[model samples]
Target: MADKSLSVYKYMCKYVVGTENHIKTIRLMNTFTDNLSSNNIKVTITSGSFGEGLQMVGSDLDIMLVDTTIDVHDEIKSIVFNPTQTNFALMTEDIKAGFAMLRFISSPNPAIRKICEKFKGSNYLSNALFKKSFLSELCPVLHGPCISDKSGHLDFAHCLHSKYWVTSASQWTMRSNNSWPNESTKQMIIKYGVLFVPIGSKGSNNEDLEWRMSFSVGEKFLIYTFSHTQLLVMHS
Candidate 1:
């Protein structure tokens, strides 16, 4: 057999989105949303090809859905965190408190800090809700809390949606930590610190106080992590 052209890969990378299967994946996730309505699961199409620039080539689509019905309080109780030790100073008390709650749930370890940062806006509501949100929506498209199984070594989600054989993966924002940062990234964060965006005041009582948030900084860095090839590979 002669060499099969890279044209195939190029073609796949080119029109990855709006493809038949991708459309079907959208429909399927929407269907999952509809079907699970009784279960009170709000399935938002999160952190996939469209969001992460990782749209790939096949009916075997990657879909992330946030199960809003889940209450993550117990998980937070188990996690060990000390906000006073965090290097995330230079922000407002309110902003700091929000990040502290996020750090409590998401960016506990310095090593995975970069990873955790990338998915921050996904849980932007978490910033507003603080401790109530946890790290459910943020993180990468493929990162989310794993739903347990009684069967074999499937640490991920698998299902047959419209006979398309959809394979899914997830990571929760909740994390267990016993330590803090001691690396270059930590140094940089401490020096530069988290930023805040002016989104206006909080309420009638506090019109003078503008609402500024630095939550998306993590996701911004996460977006940067995707190199050209990685973006193509992810989309593929």
Candidate 2:
């Protein structure tokens, strides 16, 4: 990746900046639009740019459909997400259902029954990651106002923290030879932080060596964290 291309690519991918998956997502979104319209549902992206990030290799596509008629209330509640039972045959139904579904998915105070019905029943990382992106940015990129108008920025932070913990925890568990679920390379994200700081040590120590060896090959975790941190800090 050339320096100029790298800069362009960073902007290209809002979160998981990459080229391959972004194209794949665009195709998928087009397909979804065709299918939804064929079924009389009008769909459009509200926040995210399709084909702008790393695509999940073998994950389902999670999309939010909004109806054009439903009145988007100001008070955003997180207890109405329902995909299994919520029929999305038309645009109108999808908007209402999608909003409710999102609220349910991201609600700190979620409805157990609804959550279990939708999220718990599914285990697809692609759609889950897509949802995470949309919710993180609060922009739908599908239709209507972004998710930000309803919820605060906490959703984005929580999403990042969750991804980081899942990835880092997996790596830590694997090195310790512990089989506590999702060993090293799960669908979750990986983030690297300085786990060991020497106490006036001259240079790298055993701990540093071990950490470097474990993460030297792929520093995406470190890269993403630092990059995003810098951007956010500067903006703030």
Candidate 3:
């Protein structure tokens, strides 16, 4: 049997985070797409821009570039993946042909890996939010096949609602509470990365800061914490 409270929470998320942030995310996606085109990337941008906030603060503008040929490594470094973890750079002519069809990988499933919903329809409102501790709002997709994988792009965009972001929020809660054992949790705290936090609308002037989490690729685990909430992810 499912817990009734969870349904309430899902409904709340759909209304507060989904309905509200979705609009702002769409606008941001359009602007980001235009910016990519101007850069001559011949790419498509999808929106992974929703969270507890309605795109007001701490929301990620995750996009994908496809349909053109470019160096996968260069594109990964310049746009898709966060490079603060390493200083590796791509070669100039690395952006050559025959690498047009590739898919962006978003990991850490929210439903099982992090949030465990005991209720039928109700789930943690933060279950599917993206961690943007080190992510900048603007991601430039430099090149690939934006045509064939259009649906895949959109699917990837919405997947954040069920995966990476939620895991991020949970990890954030775990770190703040010191729930993880020993010094391991300390190392996972994002000191030099950008993080995503959810905010609520306070009319048109203020926004309520809600759930958020931080992550780094080298930490080997995710850490996050909040009042009465704690979560952690360990690499095996």
| Candidates' C-alpha lDDT | 0.32, 0.28, 0.29
Displacement of residue 131 (Cα, Å) in model 2 is 16
**Model 2 TM-score, all chains together:** 0.20
Which one wins by lDDT: 1 or 2?
Answer: 1
Ranking by lDDT: 1, 3, 2
Residue 143 miss distance in model 2 (angstroms): 21
Please name the candidate that would achieve the greatest TM-score relative to the true structure: 1
Evaluate model 1: give its TM-score.
0.24
Candidate 2's C-alpha runs over 4 A off are 1-41, 44-53, 75-236
Looking at model 2, report the run of 10 residues with the lowest lDDT sum. Answer: 154-163
lDDT for model 2 comes to 0.28
Q: Write the per-residue lDDT of candidate 1 for residues 66-163, one digit (tens) a residue.
A: 33332222123344434423222121234323222222233333532332222333321122222222323332122122222333222222110111
**Per-residue lDDT tens digits of candidate 3, residues 59-139?**
334443322222122234235543322111112222122111112222233232232222224232221122222123342
Give the clash count for each candidate.
14, 18, 33
Weakest lDDT window of 10 consecutive positions for candidate 1:
160-169
Residue-wise C-alpha lDDT for candidate 2, range 121-194, written one tens digit per residue: 53111212333344433443321122332323211111110112222234453444243223343223233311
